[model samples]
Target: MSAAATDHEHALVYPDEPIYSRITAGKLAMWLFLLSDGFSFSGLLLSYGILRGSSQVWGCTTEAIAKTFGCIEEPALGINFTALLTFLLICSSVTMVLSHASMVEGDRKGALKWLGLTVAGGALFLVGQCWEYWGLFGLFGPHHGLIHEGLKFGATHYATTFYCVTGFHGLHVLTGVLYLSAVWIGTAMGKTDANTLEVAGLFWHFVDLVWILVFTFIYLIPN
Candidate 1:
């Protein structure tokens, strides 16, 4: 074949710069994954809203006291506690972005520091979630049964939806923590790159965004 024809054929097969050239393959993959995950979370939140709106009562309980005393009925979900958790996640997102900035600037130590802070924030958020769960379901010591007999999971669809939605988001936070830890280790060992850290940041930020929706829909909205 003539050289000109060969070049033309090559250009047809692959443009000089593909449409996705601006984003690394890995980052593109992460974006696609986040898009699909966003859909899943939207569906869950939508279902929660539907169930919540239809339910007659969505009862909540106060913090767990001694086993003898147990928990008392409250006005709504522990909004104060959840609001704190939401703040933690938002702060972690800031640290996550700082980590990415440090990585881009070739500051390995700074990146690691920010990433560690982000991981800590995620861990704290998870701890808060667990505490809230324990308060609601009495999953741990002393309070072994549901906090309120009337608010039992089987008794109401609200209870079931609440747990399912929040539990799913909690699982995402847990997974994001693990994912960040791995990236941090790789960054420390000089194996991870800016793109990797940025992709991780995308996932972390998505988790934060989802929680905001959950907090608004599940906690702030009145039953």
Candidate 2:
């Protein structure tokens, strides 16, 4: 047999690395990417915390935040809409994980179903954020120090810090939703199989982790 023929036969018999090994390479790359992205998010959150903690005016306790926002509209600890938003985001994370699992299990239909539910939850979360923005901008009064639109709010520092931090986080969430939408489209096109699902799942999980921190620091944490 010719040398070239033997080489060709070897290539055909020993098809490169197995799919599982290739999947591992993809997973490693994803983890590295996520690690860098995680650092970026951590920096943002840390900056927010440092600035927020330094602000004497925003030092109001959770009770004060609720009062200022008219959370209860009466007395009591009041039902904070931010808390509800947190819940929706957390629930969406669960649905996203389920979607990933369905895809891995070769249940494309199940994955689609869960993906739709996740998208709905993400929509609700975005709407809740809009309302929160309105509450801070409108009811809080530009002067109260949440929206520094035109120096109308007395403390530009406070409003600027609050808006910038929360708005940045919101944008991240929006981006994550878009990423999920793309994954869903790819799955629909039969372009994304189990391996693709795993990579996308990692991204989704990272988003959820960031949101958990944001919810705790921005809303649940007192002052």
Candidate 3:
């Protein structure tokens, strides 16, 4: 090539490229990954809404259903066990963010500490959910609830949809706990670095975000 042509090419290429530039390829990839995860969550919530909406007994009287459970408990559709679950998930999200910050500051100890706390929170939430399951199913014997009462009242379908919808969400929480625990282990073992933490944090936040919607639609909204 001619010297003049080579000189023109070099002039077109500036030499002062920023070493630590903003929005690198990796960060852009993370955003796209997060978007896919959001779609997954949206599908779950939308499917739930569609399934529950088509049910005839879902919007029936909660108070009337409560009578079958042999208790004076009112069906106040406020925050219940579901709200507690939401709180735990939110707490986990906060810990995950703290872990990310710790790693960014190059404090491996602090990062591990926060990761341990996050795992503990996840474990505690799982235990609470287990207890909740026993409470609902009456592990020692037959389950008693407005559900059984509903059956007697010819509202069997009502009980079915109620358990199925919330039970599916509980399963999601269970799976999320396991996923977070795995990430915690990797972070502790030094296998995951700041980038890994960032990716994990994105998933953790997505879980919490999904719970917010679940809590609102399933627990907060009155049927």
Compose the digit string of candidate 1's lDDT tens values, residues 14-83.
2235665567667779999999999999899888777767754445443442232443344347678789
The positional error of residue 33 in candidate 1, measured at the CA in angstroms, is 0.8
> Per-model C-alpha lDDT, please?
0.81, 0.67, 0.65
Looking at candidate 2, what is the lDDT of residue 205?
70
Q: Order candidates by lDDT, high to low.
A: 1, 2, 3
Q: Which of candidates 1 and 3 is the stronger one according to lDDT?
A: 1
- Return the lDDT, model 2, position 46: 84
Cα RMSD (angstroms) for every candidate in the order listed: 7.1, 7.4, 8.5
Q: Candidate 3 on 1-223: residue-level lDDT in tens? A: 9999998985553334477355445556867876886776677667667767785445445566546554333333335665787788788888889999999999888888887777777677766655544445675345344433332222444344445545655665566667667877887788777777777677667667766876787667766
What TM-score quantifies how close candidate 1 is to the native fold? 0.79
Best model per lDDT? 1
What is the Cα-based TM-score of model 3?
Answer: 0.65
Q: Which stretches of candidate 3 lie over 4 Å from their true place?
A: 1-34, 51-56, 59-78, 136-172
How many pairs in model 1 have backbone atoms within 3 A of each other, for residues 3 or more apart or on separate chains, i.e. clashes? 0
Tell me the deviation in Å of residue 48 in model 2.
2.4
Residue pairs in clash, model 3: 68-149
Which residues of candidate 1, in runs, are more than 4 Å off? Answer: 1-18, 60-75, 135-151
What's the TM-score of each model vs. the native? 0.79, 0.70, 0.65
Better of 2 and 3 by TM-score: 2
Number of backbone collisions per candidate: 0, 2, 1
